[model samples]
Target: MADPAGLPPRLRPSTVPPPAAVTRALHAINTCTSAAALAPLRVHILREPALLRSTAVISAFFLACGRLRSLDPALVLFASLPRPHVFVFNSLLRSLPQAPACSPLPLLRHFLGLGARPNRYTFPLMLTSLSSLRELNVAHSQVAKSGFARDLHVRNALLARYAACDPDLGHAEQLFDEMPRPDVVSWTTVITAYRNHGHSFLALATFRRMFAASVAPNRVTMVSALGACAAHGAVDTGIWIHQYVQKLGWELDVVLGTALVDMYGKCGHVAEGVRVFSKMTERNVFTWNSIIGAFALVQDGEMALRWFFRMKADGIRPDAVTLICVLYACVHAGLVDIGRKIFNLIVQGEYGFQPGIKHFGCMVDLLSRSGHLNDAFRVVEAMPSQPNAVIWGLLLRGCKDHGDSVLSEHVTMQLLELEPENASHYVTLANLYAETGRWLEAHEVLKWMKEKGLAKDAGWSLRMLEDRSSKCISDGNFMECAL
Candidate 1:
């Protein structure tokens, strides 16, 4: 009879452990594609005491477990073996990360308990399993003590943990500076660290240094560089990067392609973004979102809607983010009817997404921009979560534009109540009153502002916020921030 691993009864481990039979069984174990395929193999390994002695056999089984994320069987196998080799322990350690729920700490302790010394490769693998700051520091100290701190693989892993995961870039930057020779991964990680931590210019500077040092940036590195360019509206830099990538003949895969699309869109070069999108041979949901976002930036609602349908046609299910892009596109083109329908898709569970704050904000902006003041206000009230100041503020802008003075006063009072100390809300209230020819009330609000030491900063409370936050498609109009 054949086992779940498709190991025939003939290939099953025998007590004698024939060399040819064992080799065939080992091949089957190595090629295991699923947990069901590995389960019976585990039973055979446990039954045949002779097979348990071969570290090669044990390591292959553990690797299969890692591949299938079946760590429990590997743990059982590890427990059965006496005096397991360091390679066997390392194999289990390598698999530890693949099993999402398993923690590596206990296994590391086991490795230490068995007096098994971890090699240079072991430190890198071990470092990836550490999450907390204290755990990371302790692991690094152990690496230094073990004399593998100078190892490039160990160094890159530590650098990545600090740069990519942790917010503390001080040590990450320090690690990069101290590295005797930082490779592309090292450079890419440092660049990513700076870009992610709000240091856009610093990230680009690191990229330039990486470029000058002749360490060629890979696709991941380019993604970080493009992101920095997008944040600072450095389209010229982004264009140069795109040309450089083209010159290098690198494939515009989904990730790199999405970064380029977002960059060009944020810089108000949607045409360039569309061209990049058309050139790409492969795309994912993120790629679709970026292209749609580019159209949203240009206020090209029709194009955005067309790409939205095409994304569905391509069989990529729309995520919550995709909905946000399309909804914002509706806001840009004042397509209230279309925006309402798209928002309904979420409420109807068509996309299986509960609308989030960002989604509600987009809808509010759409209704507000289209002069559906009451509907926008109703959405704010009906949303699951409490309406944030942005929604109230968006509605207030609509009221002001449509000259609904009564609605404006109501919104203004709500804003004042929510943000009692915000000078802009006070300024808005005063401006509304003055514009209504109610000089007394305007002066009274301004007087009250002075009493509270709230200086009425003109045109900044909301406008400056929109400037920094809504770097949405060219002209930096108010829209949600890009990915």
Candidate 2:
């Protein structure tokens, strides 16, 4: 017979270890801290074919593999078993979601073929592994056929899968409507789906319907609702939700509190956001980011920096989001020195973070705005990734604003090369020339714009009518009125 690892009989371990030795090896596998520690135990289990038959030993091995996120080994061990109990299959199913390379559908089909009846836990784990709507529908059909359709947890997982995976929420809504009696999870799932898919208005509307149904909102529901409010800038509705939360006597837990802070901050109620942040006893990195972002949005760079320093003092390390907000503050405050220092810190990997493209963009914007055009261009050239349109646009705008006509012309040509069909770039270059009293160059640009079939927007003059209404007059009407 082939070994458990699929090695040929000749290549397999010559001697099966004793039962006591197998027991000790199993114990070590279960207690091991890291994935590396599980290696020898795996070898021991595979060598002694008798150990593979013990459900207990196999279950422990699968559990250890699940912890290590080593799905291939788990699948191999599962194939070795002639008949795996449902419990062992469930452990394998749960771990499949974390493995991007492995698909759960085939394993599930194989399990069903083995005449192993799936329990309640089976469907959810299987559903998570599926990435497409077609896959979800296939799983849904199976759930219905297997008489597990009415299982609440299984149905909820189905709802979540549709909500999260379906681009249009059509499947999710249909599944929700079919439910005889939908629970809070059902409502929350749909609301979150809408919110996540940029249908914040629909999310708020659903939350209202959920309230009308007399279903009390939980922390998760409130968080989703608040997130929708923030997206739509519905400060009034957000305030009402906050009051409702207070009425429920629920402690402002970190998740809920962070949501509230983000909602208030985004709604332009920075003061209220600060109040909520100050009173919160428990705060996470998200909370700090929200408050700092609020200050950055309002251009309160000083306060943003102050909170950033305070966050560091409190032993909470700043993440990418936090650094982005800090950089925004530095840009608005024109603290180029501080911005440079922060950029250097990120480059040095002081906080164990690799700066993404957004960070690089912020640095470019900072340098360009400070009139360090050459430095900004150098930074762009040195980037590991190609400079995007936005970075080039920033440099062009900076040149135009700072009256560096020589560099402005050069940057404009670069922008034109990147976006040849964009009429706005021609307009910008012409405007820059006009501002610098180069009327001939400006006229040439307008001529080029006309030749390219890009029509300039007609100028209009606002006129107050006798009835107190306003009329926008075109160039011809304005000239006639002047005559």
Candidate 3:
């Protein structure tokens, strides 16, 4: 008879192993570094279907597949199970988010249909799959029906889901307010939701409230708060957080260190950011990017480029973000030649990067700033995607700065076509005409602006008026005409 274990002809499946032996094999499978290495044991277990009854074996296999990020095999294993327990379902649920291609909802439905009940961990795993507000509402209903609504862990997961997926923060706020015993994770999620939605002030306010409540913040909480400080330019508060971090003896892990660097840099304190960066015992690509970005933000192009070289020398390859920062620095410093070299490097895949729109935008800005208007136009023409308004705006601004009214007119027409109702484009065109001494054309633009109901913003100017009495006193001709 053919080998039922599906092994090579030279190999044979062992007899049904003792429970202790099965336990040892399960441990081996759990600790496996790769899916390929786990195959033989999987086949061995398949040959002895009795081993599949053990929840540990099933969970470990799914976990191993999850670790490998191989979800299809996990699905096959799941289907082959005669009766999958909650552990198996939970393991698969945990793996779903990592597998972008697979939807967890179907598997979740299957689990429920099999008469398996979800535990606290189950709802959180299921909640991760809810990508939209509608989906979230449905999942929230499920949580309530399953009686896991009040579970702190599940509630925290729901909070995170809303924070990450929902457009409006109203629901997240309501959930936060409803939590009578909100934990650190709950506070962090609410703060993060505000920060993500660009309400930095609110995020900071929430952080202060959390502090007042005496619930000690965790690493995640600090990161979110620091991000808010960075966005809102709350340097004093950021400094306080930095001091608090030191007081708590929290090792400045790469993530927290990067956040601090970003906060200080955005607050116009690049020197302090550098100080924190230099003191870090460990660093990642994000750390390098943060420091590079700090230099870019301060318009210190030379230092930014210097750090770029240093990052390469230290064996940290530059990603798209790093390249963008370097290009921005080049633009600010007018490093035309260096910018071209960097652009070419990206085109040639020197760092394995594909130039996205932002990268192309940077190139356009760099070239236009250097008075290479023709070269900048050529870059826009060569872009894989259409140039966005920012790119055209850069070109038009360049034309105006360089007194190229003809090119400015052409770019303005394109801008107008793309964004017909954008008043700024008309203003820019009018400014170009005015700069070139084309008074009639400028007036015509003003007329068009008026016709379009784009009211020109009122201009204000100030002139110093000399006090005649003071001047007369200074000149020794003082007469107190009226006391």
Model 2 reaches what TM-score against the true structure?
Answer: 0.80
Which lDDT tens digits does candidate 1 get at residues 343-445?
Answer: 9889889998789999999998888878889998899888998887988988988898888988899998998889898888877886665556554556566
Residues 1-483 of candidate 3 have per-residue lDDT tens digits of 556897556656878666985687687877788767656767776776557777777787777877887667778777777657887789878776532675666777777777778888888887776787777777888889889888999999988988887787767788889999999999999988899899999999999999899999999999999999999999999999999999989999899999999999889899999999998999988889988998998899999999999999999989999999999999999999999999999999998978999899999899888789999999989999888788898987887678777888899988988998877677676655545545455556666766777644422100001133234334553233122
Per-candidate local distance difference test: 0.82, 0.82, 0.82
**Which runs in model 2 stand beyond 4 Å of their true positions?**
1-25, 31-53, 420-423, 426-483
Worst 10 residues of 3 by lDDT: 458-467
Model 3 C-alpha lDDT versus the unseen true structure? 0.82
lDDT of 2 at 430: 65
How do the residues 1-483 of candidate 2 rate in per-residue lDDT, one tens digit apiece? 888998777764648655785687677877877877666676677787778767668778878887787766777777767778888888777666543586777887888888888899999988888888887888999998889999989999999999988899999999998988888999999999999999999999999999998888889999999999999999999999999988878899899999999999999899999999988999999999999999988888889999999999999999999999999888888888988899889989987897777788888889999999888888778788877788888887787668787888877878888888877777777656555545555556666666777634412210111011111122223323323
Write down the worst ten-residue block by lDDT for model 2. 461-470
